[model samples]
Target chain A: MARTAGSSGPRTEEAIRSAGLALIATHGYAAMSLRQLAAEVGIQQGSLYNYFRNKQEFLFDLIRTHMQDLHAALDAALAPEGGDPVERLTRFVEFHVAYHVERPQQVFICYSELRSLEPDNLAAVVAMRRDYERKLSDILDAGRAAGVFRLDDVRMATLAILAMLSGICTWYKPGGRLAKDAVREIFLGMVLALARGEVPAEAVEAAPPPALSRRNGVARAGAA
Target chain B: MARTAGSSGPRTEEAIRSAGLALIATHGYAAMSLRQLAAEVGIQQGSLYNYFRNKQEFLFDLIRTHMQDLHAALDAALAPEGGDPVERLTRFVEFHVAYHVERPQQVFICYSELRSLEPDNLAAVVAMRRDYERKLSDILDAGRAAGVFRLDDVRMATLAILAMLSGICTWYKPGGRLAKDAVREIFLGMVLALARGEVPAEAVEAAPPPALSRRNGVARAGAA
Candidate 1:
């Protein structure tokens, strides 16, 4: 009976966690309050205690939820094929962009505020983060094994790629100037050029863009 | 008498601004106060009013000082020395890495906290950032013109490179795992490989590194 109640409790916990995630993403964890979170969930402030112990606890649950969702989503998105690096990379890119666009709040909060968690929660978040990074590094190493990508420092390459792609969150909004599809296309194209095994010196053809502000890679949230 | 006072005043003002820059770089701008800034300068709190109108004015002045430093530094660093596009690109990378490593605190604060500025300050920062980016875009364009580099999209390419180098602050501690020179070499090599106009489709020679740590790239103040 206890196990059943505990398992079923996720419904209430999920709603509370979602509210916390959205608030923390926009305002940063330092500024969010439990009162506002409870209000957003349409529950009495006291009822929130059923899901989380305090603001810190609420944030912990949200970070954990974001991490678990990300891991599960990435696994679901990985292509069935094993050794093909480009295919694996392309799928990784697609999954990342989709996940970020679909759940911008979760991604943004997880990235920015997970460090503010309690000791145990911080440990858990750090572990989850290491797991994700290792997954990316594994993909790159596998590509090296399969002779698909080239790098002197695979660690730095992974970090660079991760940083560049994650930067999408900073400028990307739901109804931005560029369509999400175009943004993905442009980003994918740039990565492809970098990832290609042998781009001859003659192939560097960066053209002057129409205008910097209207840069096509600015992805809208829903369209892509 | 007026001329001497004016000259000394400019020097003293620069000293105060420099001192504030160092303080804000480590403590964060929001958490820091104008009172502390005045104390750091050996001036009474009221004297700060004479130098700048108010707290926001003083903060804006610090940001503008840093921005001017950055713009001029990058411009001087990337002057089109007579060389292959790869060489020019290497110079740019070296300058970016060297400066970031040397002034890790200033670079870190400037990148991360510029967002917290008021609307007017934020616009000024955005414009300065755009100016720096435009110079890089032009280099990529010129590289294309010279047929020394291959890129899919110029604007995205610029962002990718900037993000990659900007991320050095997250990992490159002045006293850390890799020495400054080694970090520069590794970073430059990977960037050159990307910029050299040949996509390195072949995998790297080493065993796969462990998965990367994703949380590393997420926050501004957690470089620890």
Candidate 2:
């Protein structure tokens, strides 16, 4: 939804989008006003309309763009379809944890403000999400069919794995106890173990892997 | 924070709370007003102050009450601590799934509106939440020590399992394709598998357990 101002317009649009995500991430969407968003972006309130039709459209655009970026990134990061499901699933976990840990604010608003979306916008974003979930579900089904993944319900397993991986955004901190890749590997191990329904005897007693240390406990439970 | 009121006063307070949770769950805490909540409860706006000092207090009360109830119910449902950690963890999973499934709205608001809490209130509620997490982490730690749960990090496992089970609120429905007990069992299987780091071989190809069926794919996704 760029306007005729060319380069400047896209720059301003990106600014508005970024500021809108921040504002909505901090304040509920119903409580965020276009006036405040404009101020944050250093643009006039009317300029926001040049980027999108209205506040609803603005929110929808942010979410839709995130979903689009997510799908595209998954396509880029996902391993080839014909590989072992265990390796494919491990790559999926690593990519998800890495992507989400970097975009905590977007992830936060995407979940918290879904209620604020109008029906049509909500439906569109939800469809994009299912497409993403379907990718992982397919991996799980492949693994289950090949006798590698042990699951009572493939659907339940898919949701459980997604939720478990998506949860990283709630607690992960940059330059903290665990680096990004370290976190990804640790989570990948857990996801693979969970998906396979096999907890190796040594995995239970596996010493905390190198590059991973005790995460400082934070009081942010339930935020995600 | 109850007031010295007659029996009707307690009933009115309960009504205000019920209506407040519904309003907040639908429209979010920031957008919910005392007047709107009072109207929903069929009480005059002025009467709301008799129960809560203001809107912030009302929001805080709703969250605090939910946390308190959760802790109490968990305490009531949790197996004795000295028992096998596997059994204890199993009981925790059963208790969590059963409790959250029945209170979808409360679960939603508690997570989604945590940002709306003022700093001091947020700290209080967060502490309570960490206390709850500690209970499960303690179980994971115990299991790890007993050589039953294979994990690279006790903290990571705790968060992953909690987020995984709590996620059922996003999709579970009453009288839906899966019965409550069936959902509980399926999730319990996953949680146990995750904790033990071993996938049950039979679970992979096991016939669909009684009362559970494949969930027809629905459009809802990424709303969480």
- Model 2 chain B: weakest 10-residue lDDT segment is B213-222
- Tens-place lDDT per residue, model 2, B67-129, is 999999999988465677877887888899999999988987888788889999999999999
Each prediction's Cα lDDT score? 0.66, 0.76
TM-score of each: 0.72, 0.84
lDDT of 2 by residue, A1-224 (tens): 43434449768878988888888888868889999998998767887787898889888888888989989988876735455776577567767887899998898777767888999999998888889999999989999999988887889889999889888887787766766655665676667667877532223333432232222221111112
List ranges where model 1 is wrong by over 4 Å: A1-23, A32-51, A79-81, A192-224, B1-59, B80-84, B196-224
- What DockQ do the predictions score, one after another? 0.14, 0.23
Residues A1-224 of candidate 1: C-alpha lDDT, one tens digit per residue = 12333445668677776677777776566656667877897666777787756777777877787789899978877646463676667567656865676676677777656446667888989899889888878878887787777655678778877777777776678676544554554454445445553432222233322221222221211111
Give the C-alpha miss distance for residue B98 in model 2, angstroms. Answer: 1.2
Candidate 2's DockQ is: 0.23
Q: Tell me the tens digit of each residue's lDDT in model 1 across B109-219.
A: 677666567898989888998988887788788876666566545666787788878888766776776788877766776565555434312221121212321111111
